[model samples]
Target: MQSKLLAPYEIREMTFKNRVVMSPMCMYAVEKKDGIVTDFHFTHYGSRAVGQVGLIMLEATAVLPEGRISEQDLGIWSDDQIAGLKKLVAHLHKSGAKVGIQLAHAGRKAQVPGPIYSATKLAFSEKYQTPEALTIPQIETVVSAFQKAVKRAEAAGFDVIEIHAAHGYLVNQFLSPLVNRREDQYGGPIGNRYQFLNEIIEAVRSEWTKPLFVRISAEDYAQEGVHLEDYLMMSRWLRDQGVDLIDVSTGGVIPLEAYDVYPGYQVQYADRIRKKVGIATGAVGMITTGNQAEEILRNERADLVFIGRELLRDPYWVKTSAKLLNAEDQLEVPTPYQRGWR
Candidate 1:
């Protein structure tokens, strides 16, 4: 039987060979703290391309130095960083895998040295530093940073550009009502809260003509936090702005709550967004097996399945998954590994 998960999926001019995506996960391997790609990054990402992942998305890359999640996180804030990224993209392309990067700003969640910026002065927790509320001029600076980052991403030859608006990051801080207590233009009503992201998208779209994606924390898991209706509204705006897909993940907009965690736990959010918003979605979180991923595609739950830790555990996960679904013939095993792949 043929595998739906192995079918090619297209968005704009980019076509993915399969439904499997390497979900962006922070490696924290930049030893120089200069935000440049190191040898570890080449080996780490190249192995996955060799394993045949259709779309390999890089981890949260800072748009500003202070926006980093840590000193070791990747950065795309400078023109100097482009060559290394370009080389990485070229490496992946040689293996027939498309490349993507998540443009991010850690905001109040930043664990770096300097002060972080957010919609309000609220800190994520007692453990985190209290962030300075972004002034209007400062907000504009942040938007410009995203625009500059998009230009850098384009120069690096990325097939996809995903704005990291989820996980309680700078953009998420502006999106969630519970955290953004500002009564200014960037806060209060939903439209106002959306203004920050709206500006960033506009800036990014001006430079990025390829497939654009926005990762969102679908639910806040807090009673008064962002809910489905809020996300739907935001998603509709994203659609209007020409966003290609919504990478749906739940929680992480606030402190952890006792929510059930299991395989496919987040697929429901992705499915709902795809059906309700009439936009494509990528399902992620604990999705570990071939059957699980195949079901998501065959059932039309999501257009893509983003695998994280599982890919880290097995770089050849595509081959393994193909074997599991008895669809090994669908994947072109690398010439060097063909004998062992079977």
Candidate 2:
């Protein structure tokens, strides 16, 4: 029997070996002052590739120095960072997994030394300092930073470029009304709030021709924040901008909200966006097993399944799940691990 979870999925020119994608989880492993890929990243991602993950989305790499979530986050703000990233991409390719990088800006959540920037001047919490609101010219600079980062990602030979517009990041801050209090062109109505992201997608498209994805916080879990319906509207605009997929996740636009979270918690958002917006979607959050991933695809809820913490907990989860689902022959078990599988 065929399993949808183990089937190939194509977006543009890249064809993933299976529907399984290792979601970009921050490693914070950069040892040097410059955020370059260290040996740790090579081994960490390579092991997952060896485990037969169809796609590997690299961590949220900062597009600007001040945009880093923490001091040790990976960065692509300079050309010098390209070589190490190129090497990492090559290493993953050897394991037959398509590679991607999530370009991101931390916004008010950035815990760096200098000033933090956001759509509004509000602090995320009492512990965090108030962020400086970005001016119009500063906003243009942010778009340019993403454009330059896309060019570098192209030079790095990545198969996909995922714009990090979700999880209360810079783009998410601009999209959510609860945080974006500006009365200017960048704020006000939903269309106005989408201006920053629209510009980013346009900018990234100018440089990248391969598969493009945007990770979005579909449900803010707050009345004032974005909801699934809003994301459906946003996904339409994203489709217009040539975005290939929406990596659907929820509730990072503000502090954690009271929401029931079980396995496949956010899959419903993915299903809504895919069905209503008429675009492909990737289901994420709490998707831990192959059976759960297969059911999402079998029901036509989503096109891709993003496995996060589970992949970290077990790099070989895909292989184990393949066996559990009796689809072992469908996935490529590396030669050294074939004996164990039998």
Candidate 3:
């Protein structure tokens, strides 16, 4: 049977060749403090493109220097980084894959030397740094940083731009009541907590006309944390803000908690948000096989399947999946690999 996983998906003007997406997984390969793309990034992403992954979402690239999760993470904060990013995008395009970059800020989670910043002056753990709470003006500056990063992404020729609002990052910090303890308009109610993300989206829209995505940690896993219902409201707000899709992920608001985890564990969150909010969503986490990916799409659980660790283990996962599902012809095998496929 033909694989639904191999079907084409279109968001905005860009058409993904298949439903399989390489979820952004950071490779701490940058060799300089400048956070430019190195040969490792080119080779890493290039191999996935060559293996026929439909959309390659590059890892969490910081929008500001201090926002980096680590010193080795990629950055889009400078004009000098554009050329290297453009080169990577160009190669991925040549190999028949759409490309995206996850624009992010680690917030209090940043392990770098400088002052860490968060919505509240809270540290993720005893070992983590106590972040300086952003003043109102400082918050605006962060929003501006996102705007500038969008401009850089446009200049770098990315097909899609995903805002990293999930995984206990900067935006997630503001969204969760467990951390955002501000009395200002930026805190208190859920609507107020959403203010930071709302402003960033608006600012990004000003400079970006292409397809935009936001990765949100839908379920914070704590009793006081944001839940699936909260994410439904968040997804609705995102759709209204001109977001093309929501990459659904869960947890990471606080220190890790014990939860039942298995294959396609997060697919339920994607299904719920997509149905309730009436917006496209992507399912990620523990989704390893082509059949599992196909099942999600066939049932209309999500618009796309984001494969992470599986792809890290095997860059040619898409191709191998095509063969497993007897849909080998759906993916274009390189001339050199034609013999193996035959």
Clashing pairs counted in every model: 0, 0, 0
Q: Residue 69 deviation, candidate 3, in Å?
A: 0.5
Model 3 / residue 135 / CA error / Å? 0.6
Worst 10 residues of 3 by lDDT: 333-342
Cα lDDT over the full model 1: 0.93
Taking all chains together, each candidate's TM-score versus the true structure is 0.99, 0.98, 0.99
TM-score: model 1 vs. ground truth: 0.99
In candidate 2, position 194 carries an lDDT of 98
Alpha-carbon lDDT, every model: 0.93, 0.94, 0.94
Instruction: Give per-residue CA lDDT, model 1, range 24-62, as digits (tens).
Output: 999999999999999999999999999999999999999
Give per-residue lDDT, candidate 1, residue 22.
98
Cα lDDT, model 2, residue 145: 99
